[model samples]
Target chain A: MMNPTAAMLVIGDEILSGRTQDTNTHHLAGALTGHGIDLKEVRVVPDDTGAIIAAVQYLSDHYDHVCTSGGIGPTHDDITADAVAAAFGTPIDVRDDARALLMAHYEQAGVEMNEARLRMARIPDGAELIENPISAAPGFTLKNVHVMAGVPMIFQAMVASLLPTLSGGKPLLSRTLRLMQPEGVIAKPLAALAAEFPDLSFGSYPFYSNGTYGTNIVGRGTEASELDAAMARLAALFPMDGT
Target chain B: MMNPTAAMLVIGDEILSGRTQDTNTHHLAGALTGHGIDLKEVRVVPDDTGAIIAAVQYLSDHYDHVCTSGGIGPTHDDITADAVAAAFGTPIDVRDDARALLMAHYEQAGVEMNEARLRMARIPDGAELIENPISAAPGFTLKNVHVMAGVPMIFQAMVASLLPTLSGGKPLLSRTLRLMQPEGVIAKPLAALAAEFPDLSFGSYPFYSNGTYGTNIVGRGTEASELDAAMARLAALFPMDGT
Candidate 1:
């Protein structure tokens, strides 16, 4: 069976401005790969309403799932929720359950539920809230788009919460064979091997270290036996010493 | 004056499969920001010809400049050059200049000029080559799109070689005021400050460290004096200790 394809949308000016490095996409990619879903594309856009809405609309229409990170905070620049709501033409307001969660958490911490903090409770119409255990603010799933926090810890918690509920196909399996030769030395055989096993995808990553060049050939597919057989063929083509 | 808008397209399945963490985007973002070009969008797509062509077309049409990294190598999965040629309907072949450079470099290194290695010399029609000082393989610029290698060192070298040739606007200036208070505490004043200075862009980034929350208020604009004035107002509102 084919795995469900997904795309990632990272929203923040900090990432685009180079003030912050985005690790959330890498984290999400790894998580989705393990969950038997194919992550097809990732787009990082600034905190603009029109860009967010356009990206959300395109991704939601094209992919099975869309996971977005960033621009979900109490600050004035936090415009992701509103933009997402506009994308679907859904009205958003402070929901009772989301408000209650925030109120209880803030009250327990002896903090006031000001208007700024209350903005976190705004949920779009007909969207289910994705629980955020780290903070009281809840991420919501409006259609196929899953809007989560930009913070790594909170985003991770939300992803953990959401992935378990979604149905996924068989996990993609991979095997890697490291060769000390340059990519040019293995390119032809690798291409032949790829054609021989049309079910698997072959990727060659070149690395330079210790004043020597090497390539790591990774073969990926859903079938374990097929991947192993391909790896075996790869090993025969480029035999490593003492193996 | 408005800065030239640029978009980055990262091509590789290794990044999507979570086998590799892409650092080239961060490097390019910082470089572009320093060169006074605004990086408006970033997209990461796998090694698929259709996806690469689609992203290239979209970014080329929307932004003033497009920078692409990855998928240019001697291996089978390296199809970026051909795809980019196909995108603009230009014919691609191993040009004499590119092939001569490769031949000289490989001869010096005592490596044979095999067909796989010869693939590196394929340059599209009507393209200027971007020098790769680290590696012999040259990156080419076709129209508004600048295509470079995936390897970090080569990507950085190519970027350094390419940036000086492009015209840029005034550098974007920024000032940051760190407040120990949470973003909720300063959201109101920050919003007011943003409204007061319509020319500047205000960004509030929240951080959690040592069981305490703080927000970093960053004000950005091309005018240094205006940014400084806005920052002064911000500092007056959220006074930090010992300052």
Candidate 2:
């Protein structure tokens, strides 16, 4: 993981309509962590072109890389590709690279590429296709933005393929411990533990009840030993003995 | 829901590092959905004040409401409070209302409020504190922006408490089916399904061969009868033949 920074923009009104649960953002975040690239921001807007363009432009300019999920489908809501091009003030054309991929994909399945399906071929000028092994409609990389399918499986595959090629920092490590005691009871001691492990990032993710929801005190960092030391201190403060 | 829109800004570098698994974004999404308000966007940024302020300003202006998670801790990385003030272009100050909440909670827990602890009481001018039931330090609302604790439990509690007073749309309805078929095999039918149910949003998700992943063909709408009708039409497309 190289400390490279990135941002994710989720595009679709379905997400805002509460009709779609965004599986793409969570999956990307988890994958990016392994690469050691920091996901600095995530923004989801309706399939509105202006929102998508503004977010893509903002993130691309600010972060080392910017990844977008959703809105690149056959449907009308699939406006991500066009929006991304507009964001960079680039012209969108039916590039040979994307059309070949979409066509080959269609031919393999014994299908004719019609108007709706051709929408996948509209690539922004100077963009390269990110291989969609699972699905034939290839996602592409333009400037620093990587556009992938909205569906979680396709999205994850595209991200997995893209991550290894991207330079990143060291892999971050973590240690999680169950803390039954309330946060207020342990806040003082936990703060000391966090202070003691300045080299390691110790975040206290307190849960509510376990059978329903319980508090989990998690410690994390780039160093394993540092995480262990922090967790040890946290464990001592909130012991499992009384539970 | 009434199309009441909200966006989430998750402020943390720890998440991008893969050092921390962010639970706040998902938690807030679910909570807001339950309350019938759509969580349109979730942005995770580093502790950088400028980046935080930019995201806050963008989200607050575009959506009907904005909710931010993380970066509210006492540590130096906790720049959320400062960024919130910056987003509103207001001078930061430790208001009496916030100080009262933290003091009462600290007093009840028999802990002294030190300088670092008192920093939690700082709020932007003319903001209302969103009560934190789990921890004493309260979250606050500035205009339509609701700044809450990064911790999932506390963040959730803040939403649960604050949502009743806010306006929300009628909750959207959805129906999902696990399709064992490949995306390509069902592409035509799926496209037809989408066209048939023009008012309802339909999507085809793809999965892999490990007997693990399954594409959830989901349909969504405000009308239950319309959703049920779409589902029935979808079911008819699949032959009754089973493995």
Q: Which candidate ranks first by DockQ, i.e. highest?
A: 1
Best by lDDT: 1
RMSD of each: 1.1, 5.4
Give a tens-digit lDDT track for model 2, residues A4-99.
888888776656555556767767777877777767777767667887887888789988998888867654446789989998889997788888
Cα lDDT of model 1 by residue, B92-130, tens digit? 999988998898898899999999999999999889999
Per-residue lDDT of A1-243 in model 1, one digit per residue for the tens?
Answer: 689999999999889988889999999999999999999999999999999999999999999999999988998899999999999999999999999999999989898899999899889999989999988799999999999999999999999999997888888888888888899999999999999999999999888978988888899999999999989988987666202
Alpha carbon lDDT of residue B40, candidate 2? 67
Task: Calculate DockQ per candidate and list them.
Answer: 0.88, 0.27
Evaluated at residue B72, the lDDT of candidate 2 is 74
Per-prediction TM-score to the true structure, in the order listed: 0.98, 0.75
The stretch of ten residues in a row with the least summed lDDT in candidate 2 chain B is B205-214
Q: After superposition, how far is residue A115 of candidate 2 from its true place, in Å?
A: 6.6
